[model samples]
Target chain A: MSTDPTANFSGDIAGDILTTALDWKNAGKGVALATVVTTWGSAPRPVGSQLAVDDEGKFIGSVSGGCIEGAVVTEALDAIADGKPRLLDFGVSDAQAWEVGLACGGKIQVYVERLDS
Target chain B: MKREILEQLQADRADKRPVVLATFLKTGEQRLLYLVGKKGLKDLDPRIGEAARAALIEDKPRTLDTEQGPLFLNVFNPPLRLILVGAVHIAQALVPMAQLAGYEVIVIDPRSAFGSVERFPGITLSNDWPDEAMAQLRPDLRTALVTLTHDPKIDDPALIAGLKSDVFYIGALGSKKTHASRLERLTAEGFGPDDFARIHGPVGLSIGAKSPAEISISILAQMTAALRQPAATPASSSAAA
Candidate 1:
């Protein structure tokens, strides 16, 4: 629900997120894009926040303010490998949230999909 | 997303066109919605079109639960623009501040002496008269205009153009008596009180700002308020006399 459309993600603008994904894809690397589709409570990153990942597990941008990016990157790597899209839901109540450290009492659903070659 | 769509989206943004990417969650299919002259996309579901219009207006992305399943509307709006009608000292201070706040700053002043590149480096400068410049700029919903020149020969025409456009904010720098005289002049030009109300006369919030830089801050703060809180009563109207 952030009003600012140009909100910074890891000091990168929204355009840069997609541009990076395009660049990685153009470089012949497997690429996946994760977007926060919905959120509840105090989600650090608002819905539409995006994170781009490559097959090497390198990531740009953020989905949860460094709280659950690691988990998202892992999911993105899987999506890239399988060329399959998946929706992931993370909440404070889930033990997986504790493992990935999304302990901010917020819930977010992230959609991870690979960039079609 | 397909590479062609990604490339198209990047080019649309580069051209400052407002667009929405409607992603169907179940199939990963996306429909790129380009707004056609303030109208909803043709042949689109009225419900989804209405939601996209709302998302563009609010400049926020959203998820809509439609009968077709969940769809995510990712809004891509052009960057905000700030057009300063005078390359005064305050304009010098305001340019960097506005850019930092995510606005593309442009200074318009026919006086080359004041609008010189040396005075405002790396900033867009226009030597054309205010009216002509505003005509070319076509101030829109995302544009904010400030008249810093104390000369009616310059500020007046700009104010007239700004009042006619849908610019989010219009601020003029002057005193109460000066603004009163300005209103009289504009009134003679067929502008009504409703139009006058749009101009933040005696510009900026009542911060008692003395320095040029402080005044710039007050003006930017007022612009931010007008942009972020359109429903709130303007604080400068009481001092607009």
Candidate 2:
């Protein structure tokens, strides 16, 4: 909070995590991305937020509860290899927006895509 | 490695995504303690010569802004999104709720009247049909799809497609009887019993809520709990890296 109000956050690649991942793909590095679009009450995060994964399953963002990111990373690699994108879901239970833990009883939906360059 | 991760953090945080900072606290043979949230909240006490412990939290962790600058262990979301299959009253409420929660929400409906930018303000509204919209929006496990139309015509295809896909949570608004009817139609359309189980029919918890606003709150609350559970755990060693 000084001469630059934007100084608190990102310096580079802040606005384009998607592009960075795509750049990785363009550079011959396998890349996968996941996004949290919808969530229920008490969700820790919001919509349009993204997470990226390289061929190595290392992640860059979050979707929901963080329980299913590993799963999405694996799926993203598969998508990258095949040039396809997949949509995935998770929750407290198969019923009543129950994913796991998270007593607020909210639900979130994420999309995992393997961006092509 | 820290610099590369910092580059990713710059991207995620610049867009104002919901990111949590997980710092290494203590380390053992197969575990690491962590501190979550903005650097303003705590003092970093990483043991210089020792391995660190990284505790976990579900708030989209990101490691940027510790006293030492960019430390590892921060995890952010990948273009997080919220896809609303039905553009109805509940969606009106859900939009702001989702935005406040840090999701990039998109409202999709076949009816242009319902899905107009004029009505939605700053949101990304789509006039495409729910099924086609789901395909276009690409809802996944990191996203939540809620069918608020209460009409099978709108939510049916979206639910069927969403259930089939890996979308994290699939919920549709309806009463018990309506949900039962929905199940029958989906089953006829080749949706299996297991697939039916994936949907939060009679969506939202049994909060005994009546108003659309309350129901919206209940529904969203359920979804938030679902996503945060997994963000709280990840061992640096003895775990998948």
Candidate 3:
């Protein structure tokens, strides 16, 4: 918790993520944004969390606490290339969850969609 | 998909309208619903629009499993607002404090000198009369109304307007005797005790605050408590001198 009154964290990142996706698309770089649409149990992030990824694998924001960001980024890359959306689900059942120490446990569904200007 | 919706969403957000952008998971089709007021950009399925409106009212963002398929209803709310009915010394201290607490502060005072920018740097100033300005602002559930002038003419009308609205918090600054007299005047105008009870007279918590800045802190603390803990009982009023 920052004591600086000027430090504001109440802002939601959806608008910023969307604006970045649009700008990337307009700049001739394919872009896709992954949004956490659903969460069950102790999900690290809430629903509506977003991560924007360009064709070059550049990304901003996060849908999870590094537990599933890698997979989301890969899916976002595929979404940008195919111009189709992918709903990717990650949870404790997967071996990767244990590898990332996310077994504290929860399920998160990220909807990765391409952004075309 | 047209980028026009993105532009419109930006515009709606800039306008501080409560809006929800619902997107179909399968097709990536999106619809913008202005859920705060009845007005909308497009006429959507009544079920979805109503659900979106309910979500906006609850201030929640969620993915709803609808008959049309899974749709993510992303809720966007305007910044919380604090409308100060009087640009008194306390308001000068309160404005920046409220702004720091993530509230978009608006100060309303008919007296130009009192409401001048020099006294209240970087805050929205409304010089209109309290009743007129309150009507125009139309404080919603996300807004907090506070009157610090201690003048019945200025503070009473503003309190009436606030009482009529759905603003989550209402506080009036005055002494205990002044509050009783003020209550009498409002009662003479047909307002009952129940209506007056909604007000936190001798405004702010019973924190034994003396300085203007200290009082502002107490008021902001009370406002935050009212907003975050709606179920909690109101704090007891301290004797005002």
Candidate 4:
């Protein structure tokens, strides 16, 4: 099928995430959406950044550039399984940043919730 | 009732309606408000509703920190569209450049030969009269209309449509003298000086462009400036610089 330019959400991360979540839900795959709700000081991604995860751990988009996606993904997977929501706080401290392999200190609050219906 | 929001949001997205999806950070409560369509709820908190309206107007997604909590006002604006009234050499370059710069371009020319797919491969071509084409295209605030044709028959109708609508930027390709005459003609046709204020005559930023490609670059640059800075006026043909 020829791709319609109007239907393509390639570059828009927010639209892509929403589209992916809906597609996964329609495909019988449990899906969860993680969004960056708040950020503090040098957060890689600004607020409203999103990462959508499928039950199989397949994912697209990002809540952070790279710093906390892994953690968010893990939380997202759990959210999909439990059908529960999680608000994750990452890199609030220098020690936390070091643990997450972030050289600098910043904070990001990500809300992960399963996509229902 | 809740699934309705996502469904409506997707519907609005499909229809190219500008919307703001406001999600309360603390509660995950979501509300979708169309920027210019049927107002969803009259009872919505005035402050938050105003914030959503402001976000839609600004065409920027932002998280507003209110006394209750942080609300992520995600502005999903319809893609910016560029309506080129002439399928000339400048459009040959401008079409791709505008597409690259994230605009959906529509090339309008009543001349079937000039607007052929062979000339504008993979581009949206409208072979209708400029007024009819522009009426169908319905240039909104997110759209920029450029008339590269020096012909008044083509460009004047497009300019009239642009002036009547809220199209953010309207530029016409011409020399300073040509633009002065064009303005006079438009004024004679009932358009006032205030209506012509937004028209960027000579149609480009003055970087001493000499080629069609360079001229296209300047036009795109001016369009970008107009979209991003609606209040600031760029140097136009009438300006001394």
lDDT of each: 0.84, 0.58, 0.78, 0.77
Give the poorly placed runs of model 4, Cα more than 4 Å off: A1-15, A39-42, A81-85, A92-97, A103-106, B188-190, B234-241
Report lDDT (Cα) of residue B76, candidate 4: 66
Candidate 3: segments with Cα more than 4 A from true spot? A1-15, A40-42, A65-67, A97-106, B36-51, B110-119, B125-139, B160-166, B180-198, B205-214, B229-241
> Model 1 chain B, poorest ten-residue lDDT window?
B232-241
Report the number of the highest-lDDT candidate: 1
Cα deviation at B148, candidate 2, in Å, is 0.9
What would the per-residue lDDT of candidate 2 be over residues B14-80, giving only the tens digit for each residue?
A: 5434344333221100112223232333343444111222212233323323445433333343344
| Fnat for candidate 3 (0 to 1) | 0.42
**CAPRI class assigned to model 3:** acceptable
Question: What DockQ do the predictions score, one after another?
Answer: 0.44, 0.03, 0.34, 0.27
Candidate 2 chain B: 10-residue stretch with minimal lDDT: B232-241
Among the candidates, what TM-score does chain A have in each? Answer: 0.89, 0.69, 0.79, 0.81
lDDT of 1 by residue, B1-241 (tens): 7777878887777666778888888888877786566343566578888788778766778888877788899887777899999999999889999998888899999999999999999988999999999999877777899999989999999999999988889999888888989999999999998898888988988777888898889888888888778778464443332
TM-score of 2: 0.49
lDDT of 3: 0.78
Q: Return the top candidate by TM-score.
A: 4
Q: What is the TM-score of each candidate against the true structure?
A: 0.84, 0.49, 0.76, 0.85
